[model samples]
Target: MLNVDGKVVVLTGASSGIGEATAKVLANNGAKVVLAARREERLRDLKSNIDKQGGTAVFKVTDVTSHEEVDELASFANDTFGQIDVLINNAGIMPLSFLHEKKIAEWDQMIDVNMKGVLYGIGAVLPYMRIRKQGHIINVSSVTGHIVNKSWAVYSGTKFAVRAITEALRQEEAKNNIRTTIISPGAVVTELANIITNKEIKKGIEESMKISLPAEAIAHSILYAISQPDNTAVNEIIVRPTNQEI
Candidate 1:
């Protein structure tokens, strides 16, 4: 919590799962957290909960698919906190199926939210962070980003893209005092499985999730990454359940 305290963090997909858990953890440690997602009611409720725990938190209803909304999210955080110390591009979706099944809408949704969303977040905060010469960008990837499963082709592709993007940002911005972190979590308990329409794939995922880690597990990894000294960039973390094989 050393480097994490008193930082202003803008987190997306903050309504549930990893994002929500991370927001609570960071705020509890004295980070002024801006929770962003499309669900206003959820954001409001989360903000209230954080407030109850004596954590600094704010809510912004945002759709990661829209560039304008992400920019506004950044500005809102800046106007409120006076400085943006971190951006967590944690918004994403995983709708898995065979390529032949042609879940075009789901595929498009993944690319829009998983890939473009991360890009927009980077763009939103770069100018300000560069000016201050200090910031951190933590991107939530997946274990699938490092390995492709039978039905996880497209989802894996997007996650892989996240790793690539984070690496590029690190190479380009480390000189400007911008730290980049890629968090690749494996089979965390989340609602991500609810969106998988393929019956076969869903069943398999559910079985595998019997050994899943809690969302808080991933959040702790984030805490470790951000709590590192400012000169140390915790570049990538791949967290899988101890029993997880693939």
Candidate 2:
């Protein structure tokens, strides 16, 4: 609908969940997708499926936490596709825990993957996008960014940082003809909850996930943002299940 045909999209965390679904949706709509994730096998499998469906795709194994690796991902996308029209920073982890629990390692992990990862993605592609004079950067946030819940202090902080970063990027890059978007999604069925070590928190997340939307819902939102005309910059999209109160 937005005429995304022939656009080149680079997506991180593309092995599963929102990243995987977004890859399929964009590719099906005629966008050339470059998938990046830590899991090489999954990336390969996803690329194969996209190709089987008559979509163009290639994959590069990457960890978004590493600035160098993220830079390489951008380079690989440019090398393979000639130019990148969009960069989707979708790789993130959600290991919700109470501060009193003293899960320092988990907190550090969240900061590294969620906050620093998004920054690294932007750093990696910003130069390229600036050079191109037309590109889009999509960062995935969460509803927790808007409202801090009981056990989501650190997680929410990370997502909130994403929103701030994307907004700043939008303001700064507008002159360069680059668009930025922050996608904040509520609970959805994904492997993000599996990383929660706190049993009580995991149980609560499981219950909430029972009524969640599929990953494709967020994928569709990403597609809509990317499909918009060059003059239209869809800055932020908040998508939640109809029954989700939060």
Candidate 3:
């Protein structure tokens, strides 16, 4: 219905949550989606479901933190689909804890997966896009990037980095007909809260889950952005439930 049929889309973080949902939505709308994530089983399951629905999809086991893996996925998409029109950098991790607690490993993992992972995705696809003079890059940030909270120092920092990078990428690629879009979701129910080791923060998020929107809501927003005409780029979208305030 959105005129996105036959487009090749390479989506990271496609094993579950928003990534899985977006893969389904885009495929149903006529995109050939290449799913990538660390979980091979999950990817296979999603691929099967998409195929059963008469949608085109494939899976590549990818760890977005690994540049080699990300590059391989891009190559696979191009080889399989002939071209990749969109790269959705949706792989990220959010493990929140007080700075005072000094959970250095969790902090590092968030930085690697949330910030560097996005960079790897871009690095993998930008060259092809530049050569073709056309492509779309979608980065998933969070409202916390704009409004930080106590236990979210490192996680928020990574998201802020994503926002900044997406904006810069947009400005640099405009001349090449390459579009960059950022989706800053406030609180859609997902496994993101499972990483929060901080008891208080975990409790708060669990209680708030009652009002959080489903991952499908964010998936639809992604489809909306991707459906826009090539010349009309929707730069950024911020989605949140009506009940969520800060």
- lDDT of every model, 2 decimals: 0.94, 0.93, 0.92
Higher-TM-score candidate of 1 and 3: 1
lDDT for each residue of candidate 1 in 61-175, tens digit (9 for 90 to 100): 9999999999999999999989999999999998899999999999999999999999999999998899999999999999999999798999999999999999999999989
| CA error at residue 37 for candidate 3, angstroms | 0.6
lDDT of 3: 0.92
Predicted candidate 2 versus true structure: per-residue lDDT over 1-246, tens digit per residue: 555899989999999999999999999999999999999999999999999999999999999889999999999988887898899999999898889999999999999999999999999888888887999999999999999989999999999999999999998999999999999999788999998999999999999887899999999999999889999999999999998987
Query: Which should have the higher lDDT, number 1 or number 2?
Result: 1
RMSD of each: 0.6, 0.8, 0.8
- Give lDDT tens digits, candidate 3, residues 59-119: 9999887888899999999999888899999998877888999999999899999999999
**Candidate 1 segments exceeding 4 Å error:** none
Whole-model lDDT, candidate 2? Answer: 0.93
Report residue 216 deviation for candidate 1 (angstroms): 0.3
- Per model, state how many residue pairs clash: 0, 0, 0
Residue pairs whose backbone atoms clash in candidate 2 = none
